[model samples]
Target: MHLENLITQKVKEAVEAIYDISLQSVELQPTRKEFEGDITVVVFPMLKLLKGNPAAIGNAVGEYLEREVKEVVAFNTIKGFLNLVISDTYYLNFFNGIRTDQSYGYVSGGQNEAIMVEYSSPNTNKPLHLGHIRNNLLGYSVAEILKAAGKKVYKTQIINDRGIHICKSMLAWKRFGKGETPESSGLKGDKLVGNYYVAFDRAYKDEMLELKSRGMSEEEAAREAPILKEAQELLRRWEAADPQVVALWNMMNGWVYDGFETTYKNLGVDFDRLYYESNTYLLGKDVVAEGLEKGIFYKKEDGSVWIDLTDEGLDEKIVLRSDGTAVYMTQDIGTAIQRVKDYPDITGMVYTVGNEQDYHFKVLFLILKKLGYSWAENLYHLSYGMVDLPSGKMKSREGTVVDADDLMEEMSETAGSIAAELGKLEGYTEAEKKELYHMIGMGALKYYILKVDPKKRILFNPEESVDFQGNTGPFIQYTYARIQSILRKADFDFNTNVLAEEIEGLQDKEKQLLKDLEAFPQLIQAAAAQYSPALIANYTYDLVKDFNSFYQQVPILAEPDTRLRNFRTQLSKKVGEVIASAVGLLGIQVPERM
Candidate 1:
């Protein structure tokens, strides 16, 4: 495991024998390109110790390293760089461990450290959209990766179930003639509530314009202000066990939760904890008051509370409005405090939200730190970028927002159509075709979104994303199918002795394939350490590309030489397992057939 570290360890040990400085500072880096060799170490840092020219120092160290370090089978000096190549024998060791071990190229790294990732904190006022899909997938994928790396991950989602927004729906429902519910109307509860929300907006705007013409302020004529006040009273009534308000509140929230559950089930996002905004928004109000008493916050004349963050290079954020109402900030601060009080020893809290809230997290984190919570430093804002379409930005108000359910349905249909067009499945039953469509379509969707760097905005192109070629998830899955085909046909019994001994019997394709294999453990650790799934995505694609190239250049079961043929087939089997494992981490299932 960690091939790069092992090679660096050997080189550092060899250097300690040649010179007497702390080898801890001796940094070893991998070669950037293929021609420079597998790993390269700069000798320029060690030049002063050698007391000679850069080239002379490089040559002396390179010669000493290759002779002294068994890990370095051959090394050479070019200028001040010591280029070290691990012998092909090392690849055999790496490949053998990966092939034979049950959990190869993986470690329980965080050692039971606990972290919480909160994602898809959508409002119940509307349906889950494409933005929520991206948030959910990233959160779910990151949770899996962290768990694989040995962290105890707590996946939580805060349902935004209250506010003026929720009130709008209630107002629309009350003002409209019919006393209809989602069940009776045959409309999704969230969508029904959302329709009411739109209705409220349209009516409120028309009323406000007329009021403005009659000499009242534009804001005064907006009955939404009164409706929103009424909704808040309704929320209080529900909280205080008022039967009528609770009944309607429960009914509306039920539909939204049902819709959300289906999306999560299809997208493969699970939560260990669920927080409701209505419950927690008021929880932090007192905490802000506590801060005020401690001189952490100042109360304005109008009774609003503010945290001046100018000293921290941030604008002051309002924790409570003049009327003593909590905003998103106040609620988050409360939730964070309550979570820490509940879990006490949580090692970290990772918030998986859009990058738009970078400033919000920056302020929230600093405020937490100022409040003397030692673990405040562990709060990480995993800021992911926006998901734009090939056409343009998606606007919710403009009805350009793509619903999560709609997108999933479209992908499934696309997969079915592609399956039909390719004619890959001859005489397949409808049930079988549906299953293939599910895997391919879902796999294509997840891969297309996650393949890019999380912080980089993605332009999703339906045409390019679903293509069965290039660096997409389907491409890797397609490669898996090919390998499965070979394995089914070859049925080769792998011999460990031959695999260990005949490392050079491998073709140039075989050697490159081995190098690709060695990158797995390093790749796994790197991806987890950086919290970047794209690293794993890129590595999986590279391995498949190398394997595909090897497959075309060298035949497995078709070879005349029994030993060589068995070796290649066994090698293919090893690659197959790794691919399956990596793709599984990405929340993409590799169908046995597709």
Candidate 2:
């Protein structure tokens, strides 16, 4: 049992024996660093039964603990807090048990309901950008974390493959291109398609300006733009399954899909299953009709179906349009039901969308519950804030968004420059150096984004994130590499099976390091419970900080005492293993040597 648990149990027994009161539970907190203790038992909560001065009660409990519990060697009462100093043997025992177990913090996955995590649901018209990066990283990391916490997880994404936006790109390419293809242009399919998306926006604006010049109002001109009319016509034809239109839609979507695959691979995110809007767009239409027949939904005079959510504090939301066409909400509802049908074991789903859709998800989940799905209550919106650069917000249609590929390339370049200035890469081949630079860059990007609360907007700065100081990814990576170097130089046979016993006079630094290491398993559980990678990220930073302190104060290889040296080396190796595992949970790689 953990020290706190043991103490809480013993303290309960003590209260029953002394005050003749059966206390069910006790409040415990980490002792203040300024104080001399490992855990503190609060005395204020006991007044309900004991009815005595808080400090006196604290002293009595402290005396009882020191006398009865062998691990509790000393105690000090600060106001109502009773701080109890634990013996080094307890920490030593924990380190010895977990030292060789590289998978110390992770639990095995078995006999648990699988969870579906949906992220990176990008439109087919354009390439992924900065916002998509954040979504992918958060979703990927959360899936990995849930897996580590012993849950079966399925990572997936819905491809928005059909819409007016997609048609805009298709129409633009058809209008301006003389049979250009990705192979002919030597451009990524997604990028090529994205160029047309931008072109469509530009041409549409010019057409609007011309209409306004002919005495049309701004709104009238926008509504009657000839290019938009063409795009809408293309969408209608594609939906009607016209042979030529469907073929064009399939070909262009194929190009975008190919491009999207490359980006996902480069960003190191993957999906177990893929859902496309083309197939699922009409799914919820029938459900909406069923709702109307059942009076779960109301139909307007124009034949639109909507749910009145004003009573639920949200405005009315349309599920089906006036022309009997499915809206985005309709497709979303259908897609959600389709997932459960696809994976019968998925007990819950986590939608990794932006905070802008917070109300949308709330309404969706409520509607699903009203429709009487048991799993509706299991829905969660992993709502994250936007990722903004110092320059400003991005607009995809204007060709002003921060492309994911460009940002990744820039990160590697930044890492390369910083590494060269520090002279960190020596006697490395060109290929090896290039790979290291990418690893460092990706690590920097992922860590900087994951370390912050998902709800708080980030003002991302590449240079700051790549720095080798503070709570950055490279810093933790460097420390892990440093420990690996120590392990490589150690000549002793520090097999974990025959590790050191409770040595005489263990240093405070070493004990603290052990205490920190013991918290890893608990930290993983807490991070999973909160669905926040920030918890794991910051916990790792603290572990690295503690190890650094231990490294600086204690002599490992140079220690003449063989037993102590073995213990320290084993400790360092375990710390490195944990650091690698923790970062891996964030989908990050750590180099063995730096």
Candidate 3:
């Protein structure tokens, strides 16, 4: 059992034995630095039941716990707070128990229910941008954290492959290109397609300008743009399954898919299942019809289907058009149902979308609940804020967005420059240097984005993220590498457990590290529960800070005593391992050497 659980039990027993009254629960927190204790118990809550002065009650409980519990060696009372000093033996025992655990902080085989996490559902018309990067990193890290916390997870994405936006790229490519392909153009397929999307926008704007100059209103010019009409017509033909249109759609979408796979590989994110808008666009019509029959949805005189949710604090939303066409909401509803059907074991789903679509997800989840699905209550919207750069906001159609591939390359270049300046790659060959640069670059990118809460927007600065000091990924990676260096230098075996008697007394630094290590498993559970990788990222940072302080203050390789040296080395190794584990959950990699 955990130390908290043991202490809580003892505290309840102490209260019942002393006051002859059963305490409902105990409130425990980390002991303040000035307070000389491992954990502090608040006696104020028990005051309501015990009927006495807070300090007196605290002292009584503290004395009783010190007398009754083996782990509690001493105690101090500061008003309502009862701080108990835990024995070094208890921490040593706990350390020995977890030292050999390869996955020390992770819970194994606990929750049986599976969760599906959906993210990076990019449109096929363009290459992924910085926004998509955040979506992928957040979803992937959250899924990994959930898995570490013992819940089975399936990562998924719904690719928006068929829409007017896709048609715009296809139409522009066909109209402007004189038989250009990704092969002949020497460009990635997604980038090639993305260029045409921008071209289409440019052409559409020019046409609208011409129409407006020819005496049409702004709205009329926008509605009458020739390129817009062409794209809409292409969409209609594709929907009708016209052979030419279908062939073009297939060819273009296939190129985009191939490009996306390469990007996903580079980004280190993968999906267990892939959903396409093409197949699912018409899926919810039948469900909407059924809902209308059941009075869960209503049909207007013009034949549009709607669901009134005004009483639920939301406006009425349309599910199907008068022409019997499904809207985005209807398609999402059907896609969700289809996912559950596809994965029957899925007990919950997390939709990793931007905050812009917060209202959409709320409506979708609520509609599913009204439809009487048991799993609807388990749906989650992992809505995150937009990612901006120092240069300002990105616009895809204007060809101004920060392309993900370009950003990654820039990060690698920045890391390489920083490494060169630091002169840490003296023995590394060219190829090894390149690989290290990429790892550090990607690590910095992922960590920087993930360290912030998902609901907060980011103004990312690439140079700042790669700095080798102060809460950055490279700093933590450097500390990990330093630990590896220490382990390599220690000739004697430090893997064996250090017996409690062999180590004499624990230093303040070592005890602090042990306490931080003890918090790891609980931290994992908390991060998983909150669905926040920021918790994991910041916790790792704090742990690294603790380890660094210990390293500076305590001598491991230079210690004269064999037992003390071995124990310190073992503690360092465990800290390194925990750091690796924590950062891994954030989708950041650690280097064995800096």
Pick by lDDT: which candidate is best? 3
Which pairs of residues clash in candidate 3, taking residues 3 or more apart in a chain or in different chains? Answer: none
Q: Distance from true position, residue 541, model 2, in Å?
A: 0.6
Worst 10 residues of 3 by lDDT: 494-503
Model 2 lDDT per residue over 543-579, tens place? 8998999999899999888778888898889889889
Count the clashes in each prediction.
0, 0, 0
Evaluated against the true structure, the overall lDDT of model 3 is 0.93
lDDT tens per residue, model 1, 1-594: 365666566656656765654465566675655455677788777665556777776666678767766767777777877787777677666666666766776676655688888988999877888888888888888887877777777889888887667766776788882888777888766677777777777766666677678888756776435555666786677668788776777777887788778778888778998999878978788889899999999988998999999987788889999988788898888899898787765878889889999999999999998888888888888788999877788876544577787888888888778767877787778898888787888888888888889999988875566678898877888899989888878655655445557645446678777877776776776776677788888889988998999998898888877777777887888888889888888899887776
lDDT of 3 by residue, 440-495 (tens): 99999999999999999999999999999987888889999999999999999877
RMSD of 1: 2.8
How far does residue 155 in candidate 3 sit from its true spot (Å)? 0.5
User: Roughly what TM-score does model 2 have, to 2 decimal places?
Assistant: 0.95
**Ranking according to lDDT, highest score first:** 3, 2, 1
